[model samples]
Target: MTFRAKQSVRRFILGTAALACACAGTLSAAAAPANLAYDKPAPTINPKLTALSKAMQPKVYKVSNRVYVAVGYGDANSTMVIGDDGLIIIDTTESLTSGRAVEAEFRKISKLPVKGIIYTHHHMDHLGGAAAFVQPQDAMSGKVTVISQADTMKLLASSETAKANPLFTRDIMTARFAYMFGAYLPKGPEGVVNNGTGPAMVAGPVGLVPPNKLVDDTLDVTIAGVRLHIVRTPGETDDAISVWMPDLKMLATGDLLMGETFPNLYTLRGAEIRNPITWYRSIDRVRAFPAEYLVLSHGRPALGRDKVASVLTNHRDAIQYVHDQAVRLMNKGYGPDELAAAISQLPPHLRDDPYLAQFYGSVSSSVRQLYASYFGWFEGDPTTLNLLPPKDRAQRNLALMGGEAHVVAEAQKALAARDYRWVADMLTDVIRVNPSNMNARKLKAQALRQLGYAEVNANARNWYLTSAQELEGAPLQIQNDWFRGVASPQARVAQFNAMPGRAIIGLFAPRLQAERTLDVHKTLAFVLSDSGDQAGIEIRRGIAEVYTQAPPSPDFTVSTTKAALARLAAGDTTLAHLIESNAATVQGDRQGAETFMSYFDPPLKDWSDLHFTTR
Candidate 1:
C-alpha cells in the first residue's frame, strides 16, 4: 500500500520552453511580428487587455534614500528598507524563487545583511518566501527576527489557502483567478494582458519562517537603527498590520491599498466573509498617520503627504459608498444577485477617480458580498428554502424543456443570433445533462470566449476563457502536482509544532479513504521522540479522532521522531519504509497498523488539474 513517487507533473498551457520559442521571434512591441501569427490561436485579442499588460510589468521603484519597492515581480511586491546597519526586508513575494530574485535585487542596491523581516498579514504573498531573505539557522541563532501579528498563523490556518477541502476550494477559485490574473493566457496582443495587481505568476517554492517576535496591537521596535512603529490595520485579513516609519515619513500598507484599483471587499475565491465596515475603519486608522510617503505591498509608492492622504481617503470613501448603498438596498429588500446589478455603478465622482477602477476588484462583486453578509443566502423566499442539487435540478429542467439535443438546438439558435448570454445559460443545462454534447460544449465555449473577451475584471475574463479551453478538450492542467516539493524536515517540524494535537489529526482525517478504513478499528498511540509529545488516534469504523492523552492498552504504538512522522505524513516515506530503514518503530500489531496507515490517502488527496465544472 506504500506510495511510489510519480514523475514530475508536466501540465503546462504554454510551457516555459514553448513560451520562449513563441516570444523570441520578436522581443518587443507585439509578440507576433508582421502579420505572421503565433503558432497557437491568440489566447485573447482583447485590445484593452493587451494595452493594459504593459503597465503591469515588474519594476523596482526607488522611493527615497532608504526605501525601494519591488512591484509586479510575482503576485505581490517586496519592499526593502536599507537601514543604518543591515537591511529590513518587508513582505516577501509569494514564492522563494521569486523572493530570492528580490533579495538579489536588494544586494545590488546595498549588501546589507537582513536584520529583520516583517509580515503585514497572513497571506502567502506576504510571508511564504521568508527563507530567501534570511536562513532558518540565522533566525534560530537570533541573527534575524521574523515579526508579524500575534494571530498571523492562526488566521492562515483558517484562510482560503489553508481550507479543509483545498481541491474543491481551488475548483471554486482557479478558473476565476486565471481570468483575473490572465493566468491561462499567453502574454501578447490577443492573450493575457495584465494582472490587475501586478504581472506574472512565476514558478517557485513556498517557504514559511515563523515569526520570532509577534506584535499585539502595536509594537515599537528599532531594528538596524530604523525606528518602526508597527500598527494594527486588519483590512484584508484579521492578522493585518502596517509599519510606520517616523524617521522616513513612510507607511508600509500591506494589501490595504494596492495603488490603482477598487479594494476587494470579497474575492470570488471563497473566504470567510470580509467586513467592509472594518476594512474602511482600518484604512481610516492609517489615514490618521502623518505619512509623507506611502509604500504598498503591490504597486508604486506615493510620495508627499497630500498625494498619500488623497489616495487613502478616496480608496476608503469608495469602499464606504459601495457598502452603505448596498446595505441601503438590502434594507429595501434586495437579494445578493439583485444588489450586484443594482448597486454596481458607482457615483460619477467616485468612478472617475482612477484608484477606484474595476481592474482587480469590482463594485458588483462587492455589493453581492455585502448583501450576502447582511442577509445570508435566503432572500425570504420559500421557493429557495430547500432546493434540489444542481444536477437534480438540471435533470428536472431538461425533462420539461425537451431533451439534451433540443437544448443544444436552442443554444445553437441563440449562438447564431449572437445572444451569447442566453446561449451560455441554455447550453449550461445541456452540458450538465450531457457533458459529451460536443455541439453544446463548442457553442458554450464560443459564447464564453465572447464573454471573456468583454470582461473588465481580470478574474472573470480568466475564468471564462479557461472554461472555454476546457470545453475545447482535455486542457493543460496540473495532475499529480510535482512543482511544490516537500519541505525540509526542520521546516515541517516547525509547522507541526505550531498546531494543536487535535487539529493536526483533523488535517489527516480528510485524506482517510473511508472504504479502506472501514474494518481498521484500532487505537494507535503516536509518540514523537524529538519533542516528547504524544497523541492517541482512535479509528472507529471509518472515522478517526485524536486525543491529547494516550489511550491505555492501545492496539498499536508508533514511535517516531517529529521530523520522521512529518515525512511519513507527507508521503516522503511510508510506514513500511520507515520500519525497514529504522526511522520509525511500531511496538504493537505492526502489520495491522501498517495496513491502516496505508488506508490514509497521500498528502495531496485528489490533487489534479481539475476541469472545475461538473459538466
Candidate 2:
C-alpha cells in the first residue's frame, strides 16, 4: 500500500474506535447544558407516561408454540414464525444492531433459514434491518422472497431524498423526526422516557433491502409448509400490510394496531394526512380475521382469541370516534383548534380502555389532523387568508400588550399562577418580537418544561422538552452525533454501495445550490462499471436534473464501480485519491467535474441551526 493509503487505513480504524466509544455510552450520558440555570434535577413526570416504560423492558415473548416476538430491542418489534423447514421473519425493527440482537435470541429458539421476510410497511422502523435477516443475493435471486405492498417502493422513492416540487424537503422532515423521537435529548424523566410505541429509536446501521415480491390486495401462499396470507391494511401508512396464519390462528398487525396507544392519525414529524375513515376501515378488515393471537410490529403480543378481538375492536372504535367527532365539530363551523378543544378526550369507555391510551398518538393532534384532512389550512376564515407575517404580527401584538417588558411581566405572573399554556403563548409574542431577549426566552422555556412534565403523550413530551432545550440555547448541535451513531463509516459505505445507481444520482438534485449554479451549466455522467448502469445529472441554470439515460454529449464522465462511488459519498475516500488509485477514471475535463460538484450544497454535518423553537 502507498504511504497515503496506509495513513488512511489508520485514520479509519481510529475514527471507528472513537465512534464505538461514543455510541456505547450514548444512552447513559446526559445532554450538555447550554444554560446552567435551566439545568436542574429531573422534572416531575406524568405517572402514566412513566408507567408505560415498564412495557418496554427488553424481553423475548413466546406467543405460542410456533411464534416468538422480540420487543424493547428497538423502536419496533420483530417476530419469527417457525415453519417445517424454515422461518418467516416479520418486521425487522429499525436498525442493524437491534436486528442482530433479536436474531441472537431467535437463534436460541430454533436455527432455521429465513425463507421469507415480510415488511408490514415501508416505514424505516419496519423494514430498515432487512439485511440482518436475509442475504442480499438470496433476496435478489428469489431464494428468500422479500415482500411488501405494491405502493411501498413508490413511497420509499419519495423519501429517498427531497421531492421534485420541494414542499417539505427531507431535511425538514429529518429535523422534525429527530425532535419527535427525542433523538438528541437525554434518556431520563426530564427528557425522553420512552418512545410511546417502543423502548426507543435505536441508533445503528439502517439496512433497507427493497422487496422482491409485491402484494397488491391479498396473497395466499405456503412457505416451508406454513400457510400464510398477506393483506393490505393501509392504516398508519398508505402501504401498510398485515400477515395472517390460519393454522396458527395468529395475525401479525403492523402499525394498524400500534400496540396500546391510540392510532397515530397524524404524526408530529409530518406526512400525508392519514384519513381516519380509511384508518378505521383498514382496522375493520384486520378485525375480520379469526385469530387467537395478535402480534404487533410494536409492543407486546396479545394471547387468546378474546383478548385479540377486544384490542382490535377498541383500536378501530377509537379511530372512528375521533374521525366522526372531528367532522361533526367541523360542520358546526369550528376550526382546527376548536375541534381539538371540543374533543380533546375520547368517551369514558375509550378514554379508560387500557388499549386506547394516548401514550403515542393523542386525541387533540388527531382532531387537528382530521380537520386539516377535510378542510385545507383556510379554516373558513377570510381574514386568515392574508394574515400579517409572523414577525409583524408579533410586533403588533407586543405593542397592544404594552411592550416586551409588560408582556414578559404578565407571563411571569401567569407562570407564578401555574398557567403554563397561557404563559407559553404570551411569551411567544415577546420572544418573536425580540429573539435575542433572554428573559422572554427563558420564561418560555420554563413554561414549556412544566407543560412537558404534565403531558401524557410521549411524543408531545419529547417535543415540548426538546423545544424548551432549544429555547435555552442548549448546544443541541451535538444531535449530529446521534445521526452519526446510526451507522459506522464502513457500514454507511456498504449501504450506499448497495443502493441503485439511479437512486444514488437522484440524491444529488436536492442539494443543488441554485444561486451558485445560476450561471453554470454542465453535465456529469456516471457509469457503474460493475452493474452496467448509466445515470447523468444536467445542471440547467439553477436546477440539477437527474436522468437514468446516457447523455448524448456529457461535459464530464466518471467510469467507476458503485463501491468506489460509495466510498466517495460516505467521505471514506477523496475523489482525487480514487482517481489516483485507478478506482475511477475521468473522461473530459476533470477540473470541470470538480467545479460541477461545487455547485451543490455540502452535506449538513451539524444540525444545531435547525432549531425547533427560538428561531
Candidate 3:
C-alpha cells in the first residue's frame, strides 16, 4: 500500500481504539454524589503546586458526571473531557514528554479514544503536543475533528513570529523556562527541592497543525451524544475561544479564565495590545453559561455550580473593575503612570482571592496597554515628544550625573533601598554609558533578580530574572536557521510592503550613517530567494519608494533570503562571504547595493557600561 494509504488506515485504527477505550473506562469511576456538600474546602494548597498553583491546584478533579480536568503544574494546563463514546481535549501542554504524562493520567481513569481536540488559541503551550493525543493519521483524516476559531488558523500559521524574531523569542523563552519549571512551579511557598528536574525535555519538531474545523462565532458539535459548545471571544489573543458543555454544565475557558494572574494585555515578547474592555466582556460571556464547574486552560478546575459561578463572576468583575477605573482616570486626564499608581490595589474581596492574585501578569502593565490603546504612546509632553536615541540619551544622562562612578553610586543606593525598578532604570543608564563597567553589570543583575522575585506574575518574573541571567553572561547566540525553516519569503515580502509608512521609517535610524542615501523618487520592486530555507528576503531600493515582492522577479533583483538579511541587519554576521561566494546575486547597480548596505549603521557592542551608564 502507498504511504498515504497506510497512514490513513493507521489513523482510522487509532481513532477507533481511542473511542473504545474511553467508552469502556466510563464505568470504572463511579459518579460522586451530587449536591453532597463535601466539607473539604477544595484542596487549595498543594506544597508542590503552591508557587504556581495560586490560580488552580494541579490535582485532577471531576468537572461533571464523566468529564475530568487535570491542571498542568508547568507551562499551560490541559483540560480533558471523557464521555461514553470518546474523549475531547483542550490545550495540549508544551512538550510531547509532558503530553504523555497528561495522557497517562487520562488513561489511568479511562481507556477511551480521543475523538476530538479543541484549541483554546494558537499559543504553542496550548497546542504543541496535539500529535501525542490524536496521532498524525487521525488528524490528517476526518476521523478526529480538531477545532479552533476562524482567526485561530491565521494565528497558528503565523505563530512562527517566535522563531522569526529569535532575539526577542529567546529572551522570552529564557524567562518562561526559569519561572514555569526552574523553581516556581515545583517549589510552592514552603521551599523548593532542587532534584534538578527541569522542564520536560521537548524534542522533535515544534509545529501545530491547523484545526480541521473552524468556527467564526459559535460551533456546536455532538460527540458521543454529548453536546459541546465552542464560542469565540477576543482576549489574550484576537483569535481566542472558550468551550462549554451544556449537558455537563462544565466550561473550559481557554486562557481567558485563567486562575489568579491578570491577563497579559501587552506581552513583552511583542504582540499587539489586547483590549481590556473586550477581555472583560469575554469573561462575562462565559459566566452566562449554566456552568456548574469551571475548568481553565492553565490551572485547577473549580467544582460545584455555586463556586464556579462565584469565581467566574469575580473574574469578570476584576477585569471590568480595572477597565472601568482606568477609563475613569483617563477621562479625568490622568496619564498612564498616574492611573497605574492610583489603582494599586484590587477590590477588597478580590485582593486575596487566589484567583485574582498577580502570578503571571500585572495590573500596572495592563493600565499602560489600555492607555496606549486609547491615546497612543505620546503623553503630550513636548520635551518627551521627540526623544533622542536611547544611546544618546544615556550619554547625556551620564555626563549630567558626573560620570559613571556617580551613576553607579545612585544605582547602589536604589538597590540598598530595595527599589529594584529604579535600580534597573538607573543601571540601564550606567550600562549604556560605560559598557565595560563590570560593577554596573553585577548591580543590574542583582536588581533584576530582586524585581523578578517580587513579581507575582510569572511572565514578569521570567522577564526580570532572564534579564539578570543574560547580564550575568548567558551566551547571546542568535538562531538564524530556525527562521529559515518556517518563514516564507513571499509572505515576508508582502508583510514588509503592507507595513505602515511610519513603521518602515522606524526601521531606519538617523544615527546609522550609510555611505550615501538612495532617494527613492519612485516606487521600486525586487525579487526574493531562499538558501535552502535558511535565508530569504527581497532587496529593494529606489529614489521615491522601495519595496519587496514575492515569487516574480522585480525590475532589479538581489538574490538573498529574509534570514540572511535579518542576520546582516542585526550585525550578527557580515555579508562579504555571500557576495564573494556568489551566494548573493545582485541584478541592480552595484552602487545602489553598496549605498543600501552603507545606510545601515553598524551595531554597537559597547552600548552599556557594567558599572555606570550607557553610551
Report the C-alpha lDDT of model 1 over 179-283, residue by residue, as the tens digit: 344444554444455566655444445556667788989999999999999988877777789999999999999988865678777776555556788888999
Every model's Cα RMSD, please?
Answer: 7.4, 7.0, 9.9
> How far out, in Å, is residue 370 in model 3?
1.6
Clashing pairs in 2: 204-486
Please give the clash total of every predicted structure, in order.
6, 1, 52
- Model 3 TM: 0.70
lDDT per residue (tens digit) for residues 97-189 in model 3: 446656767788878899888988876667756776887668778888888887664443333223243222322333333333232222322
- Models 1 onward score TM values of 0.80, 0.81, 0.70
Off-target runs (Cα >4 Å) in candidate 3 are 1-50, 53-58, 159-209, 386-428, 470-615
Highest TM-score: which candidate? 2
The list of candidate 1 runs beyond 4 A from truth reads: 1-48, 82-86, 95-97, 103-116, 128-146, 153-191, 205-210, 478-502, 510-522, 541-543, 567-606
What are the lDDT figures for the candidates, one per model?
A: 0.69, 0.77, 0.57
| Error at 209, model 3, angstroms | 4.3
